[model samples]
Target: MENKTTILSLFLIFLFTLPFSAQESYFPPEGEWETKEATAYQLDFAEAIEFAQDNEYSESRDLRQAILKGFQSEPYHKILGPTKKRGGPAGIIIKNGYIVAEWGDTERVDMTFSVTKSFLSTTALLALQQNLITDVNDKAGNYLWDDTFEGPHNSKITWKHLLEQNSDWSGELWGSYDWADRPPSDKNIDEWRERELHEPGTYFKYNDVRVNVLAYSLLNVFRKPLPKVLKEEIMDPIGASTKWRWYGYKDSWTTIDGLKMQSVSGGGHSGGGMFINTRDMARFGLLFMNNGKWEGNQLISEELIKEAVQPSKANTNYGYMWWLNADGPRQWENIDENIFYAAGFGGNFIIVDQKNNLVIVTRWLQPSKIEEFMQILYKNI
Candidate 1:
């Protein structure tokens, strides 16, 4: 009787401790994550689904128009690359490492646009951890002595500056003129071209030309392709799908040490960046929400992520290629301030709410409706 009672007590204790222990150690396996209904989280998400459906972009709206407009602007040429048939109203929401909700063709790989910048920034962080380039604030000229970093203005650029999109690098790269990229609608071509250069770290501009310049500099720093670096360090460990592809323009190819290398773009702005499905993006976001740790392994240093999300002095809402929402004048209202996101063109977003242990990947959503979408998701939490 005593032995039986002891066994029963031990079993009860094990049952009591299971949830806590499991919660701390659980991680979805590669390509084999589990899913749960809204009820699993003890929340009604029916209204949330409706809210997401209602906020989706119109199918009839031409997404390529703005891209074409930018392409037809001054000093433009045919952008060389690939663009998949962009699907409509697709998203996936992961709660506590499980798929709580998914909509549209979640498996269809599509262009991720500037969301690639966050990935680009990750490579830089990894390089920092590996001590490849040492300090981010060190002048880019230290590693790159070519024309891209030799000019007085370009020489002042740093890895941090490039990551934050304030490098203001002045030059053409792979046929795209720096001044001609996404020029202000109000400014004439001459005004935009001759605009005074801002000191590297003092100004913020979301220019893809400069972003590509950063990619190029990173290529020189890594002494290899960025995708290979990401694959070995990030994607492979995260168990991301093999279908995703990073692309660069045809002319962007160059030879390095007798090896043919193509430096990928930081966006799909001129067509070519990360083409990944929602599931892989969810894994990437989950990695970040867990503070750069994965499956008990510190994939990226916590200190780097903290600094990565730190609002830049030049732009309060911008970090090291990550968009922040906490304490700025233009903060995302009605949502947790701790949330940060990787935003891209065509309304692709990876909203990371670490506070809730949630990662939401939305593609082709209406940009203006993102705040409301997040708010609705918050209510479900």
Candidate 2:
């Protein structure tokens, strides 16, 4: 009995000692560094391709490797956030421009949050440029709602007001509440005039409800749901996925369905919850990089692109729902200084630097401040 027990113990020890090599990470031993230890790194696209193809990075081997190649030269530097500030998962790089070189989890896709505003602003710009919609100076009240931004059409809001984040509406700001708020729970077109609490364009206050107000204005002018307009005008031209979708209320573009599905209203945002994949976002960035034109066709006129992208009010750098990059130093004081960007809550950023011929797309975790991450990105890139 003692000898039998000894044999059994020996067998158990052997089983415990066996290595389950599968659990170990297998990057080309050279590129593998501690998550926080990145100092300097450069990618050889050709080498990346070879490595991806040879080892198969994700569960997808050959084909997936091909699609993932676009990120090889992407440059995303890592910066630690200050405590509980900026927390996010980001994909960064410089392509056809300066890039963010971090390859976050490849299959990850998160809500774009406020980045949706950039899309909204761009859509309005394109519509106005094509004459599909009127100019920014047009009074939104005259076309869309029955009321002025301050109520009654006496002094209406203009496209400029909406873009500048100064629609001057009496609507309440986002206050931990999206369900029942000004711009009201039960929406009505006729009641719009009475909705004003302030005169239009008096001041700049960041209230996303004003965004919804602007949205209804689009619906009125186009006489169609905002999503369909975006699909035909912007998304299609940019070659974004047919699978892309929006979520919103009945008459808004923010509302949408799912893959193998569809819906029209632009409803969800009062602020964010947009879900888009890396490929689709890359296409969106490409569209902006190409300057509102794709292939040989002019989808969105160049004029609106110029106006919408620049800072709105002279003192403040915010431009028509987009943030101007002018708050910081110029990438080159002498080269050219007109570069700018679109920033979304969390870490989503579409940075356009015309001076350097660079467009950087970074999607990071939001709500949590990511100071460390941004510092790393700006300094390194």
lDDT of 2: 0.50
List ranges where model 1 is wrong by over 4 Å: 1-22, 59-66, 69-77
CA-lDDT, candidates in order:
0.84, 0.50
Model 1 score (lDDT): 0.84
Q: How good is model 2 by TM-score? A: 0.60
Lowest summed lDDT over 10 consecutive residues: which window, candidate 2? 77-86
Best by TM-score: 1
Evaluated at residue 189, the lDDT of candidate 2 is 41
**Whose lDDT is greatest here?**
1
Each candidate structure's TM-score, on Cα atoms with residue i matched to residue i, is 0.91, 0.60
What is candidate 2's CA lDDT for residue 270?
28
